[model samples]
Target: NKRVNHKRVYRLMKQLKLKAIIRRKTKRYKPFTPEVTAQNILNRSFNETKKNKKWLTDVTEFKLKNGNKVYLSAIYDLGSKTILSYELSSSNNNQLVFNTLDKAVKKVKNTKGIIFHSDRGFQYTSRSFKAKLKEHKMIQSMSRVGCCIDNGPMESVWGMMKSEIYKGNKNFSFINYELALIELAKYIHFYNTNRITLKMAKSIA
Candidate 1:
C-alpha cells in the first residue's frame, strides 16, 4: 500500500529497535599474480652520491574537468635530484612506463648495474618491463610488499610537485586535457632547471 512506504517503515522500525539483516555477496574473481617480481635491493637506502647510481620511478594521475584522467610516469634520479624523463598518457598501461624508461635510457650512455627502484606496480612487475630492464643491463629493485617507505623519495617528490602546481589546493581539476599536459610539461622543466633548484640553492646558501 502507498501508506506503507520505506520511510514510514524505517521510522516504525527505529521506534521498535528493529533492524534488517543483509548478507554481502562474495567476489567471484580470483587474485591476480604478476608475471615477475624482484627483491627490494634499495631497501630504504635512498641516499646516493653519484649521478645515475640510483633512480626511482612511479606513476601518478591527474583528473581533468571533463572527468577524464591522465597518467604521468616519471623517473627521478636520486643523486642529481632531477627528473631524467617522464611520459604522459591517457592510459596507465605498460606502454606509459616503457616509454618513460626508454626515453631516460636514451639520454644516458651507461646504465649498467644502476639500481632502478620502484613499487610492485603491475606495469613494473610485468614480463615485458623486466625484459626491457634486462636488455638495458639495469638492476631491478622493488619495494617489498606493504612497505611504502622503500619508495619514499619518489613519493615525496610527487607530493612536492603537486603542492607547487596546485598551490595547496586539493583535487585541482584542469579545464582541458591538452592544457593540463602543457602545464605539467612546463612544471617539470622549471623544476629541473629553475624552480626546485633555486629552492635547494637558497636552503644551502
Candidate 2:
C-alpha cells in the first residue's frame, strides 16, 4: 500500500474537475405586495435589554432530495439570541409565519409588548398576520424595502445555519424531505443548546 497526501488528492480532483455538484436553490415565492408596512422600529438595533421585548422572524428555504422545497420560519429573541420557536412547511405562506408566531407566543410568558421585526415579505405584510400581531397586542416592525441589513441578525442566523448543516454536506442531496425536517429539528436543538457565541459566551438555550 502506498500513502498519498490528502492535499495532493484534492489537487488531483480539482484538476480533473471532479468537484461535487450542488444545485443552487432559487426563491420561488411570489413577490410581496404590502397590505400594511410597519415602520422600522427595530432600526438596526439588534440588541434588547429584556427578554421577549424584541424578536425577529424570517423564512428560509431548503431544497430536498425530491426537488421540492421546504421553508423554515423561526422567531429569535434579540435579548438572549435564542430561537424561541420555529415551524417548517412545504409552502412559504402566511400560515407558516403565523404558526411560527403562535408557537413563539405560547412559549414566552409575555407577548403584549414585544416588538416583532421582519422583512416586508408577503407573509409578514399580509393582513391576516397583521391581525395576528394585533391579537397578541404585539408591535410589528418591518425592514425597509429592499434593505435586508435592517434585519441583519435574523439573516445571520440563516447564513450560519446553512453553512454548518447544509452547505458542502453531500448527505443533504440524498435525504428525503421528512428526514430533512427531522435533521433541521435536531440542528435547531443543538444550535440552542451547544453552540457558543462571543456576545453571551454561552449557548442560546
Candidate 3:
C-alpha cells in the first residue's frame, strides 16, 4: 500500500498529464415535461411562524445497483424545517407527488390556506395536482424557471440528507432497492426526531 507516497504519485500523474476521472450517474428516464408555470410566491422567504402556514415539496432521484432509479417525494415544513411526509417510489409519476401531498395533509393539523411551494415539475403542474390543491384549499407556489435559489430550502434538505446517509458510504451503490428504502426510512425518522439544526437550535421534531 505504501509503494508510492501520495505527493510523489500526484507529481508523477501530473508529469504524465493524467488526472482522476469522476464518473457521474446519468438519468435513466427523460426529464419531466412542464405543464404549467407558477410564480415564485415563496420568493426565498423561508421563514414562517405557524407550522403548516408554508410547506415545500420536491422530488429527487437516486440510482440503484441494477441501473433502475427510485424517486423520493417529500414535504418540508418551512416553519420548523422538518419533514412532514415523504414517499418513495420506483417511478416519479404524478401519483408519487399526489401520494406525498395526501400524506402530508393528513399528518398536519390544518391546511386551509397553507402555501404549498415547489418547482414547476410536471407532476406539480399537472391538472390533477392543481385540482388536488384546490380541493384542499392550499395555495400552490412554484420556483421560477431556471431559478434553483427559489427552492433553496427544499434543496438544502435533500443535500443534507444525501450527504449524511449516502455520500462517502462505500457500499451504497451495491445496495438493493429494498435496502435503500429501509436506509432512507431510518434516516428520515432520525432527521425528523433527532437531528438538530442551528436555525432551530433544536431537533425539528
State the weakest 10-residue window (summed lDDT) of model 3.
Answer: 196-205
Off by over 4 Å in 2: 1-32, 167-174, 202-205
Q: Top model by lDDT, which number?
A: 1
The 10-residue segment of model 1 with minimum total lDDT is 23-32
lDDT of 3 at 94: 95
Per-residue CA lDDT of candidate 1, range 42-78, in tens? 9888768688999999999888998999999999999
Residue-level error in angstroms, candidate 3, position 38: 1.5
The Cα local distance difference test for each model comes to 0.90, 0.87, 0.86
TM-score of each: 0.82, 0.81, 0.83
User: Which candidate gets the maximum TM-score versus the true structure?
Assistant: 3
Across 1-205, the per-residue lDDT of candidate 3 in tens digits comes to 4587899989999999999989989758567776666777788888786688899999997778998888999999988778999999999899999999999989866788989999888899998999999999998899988788899989999899888877778556526779878988999999988886785574354
- List where candidate 1 sits over 4 angstroms from the true fold: 1-31, 196-199, 202-204
Q: Write the per-residue lDDT of candidate 2 for residues 1-205, one digit (tens) a residue.
A: 9999999999999999898678899858555468888999999987676788899999998887788889899999988778889999989888898889888888876689889999988888888889999999999999998899999999999989988886777456526778878898998998888887776564344
Mind sharing the TM-score for model 1?
0.82
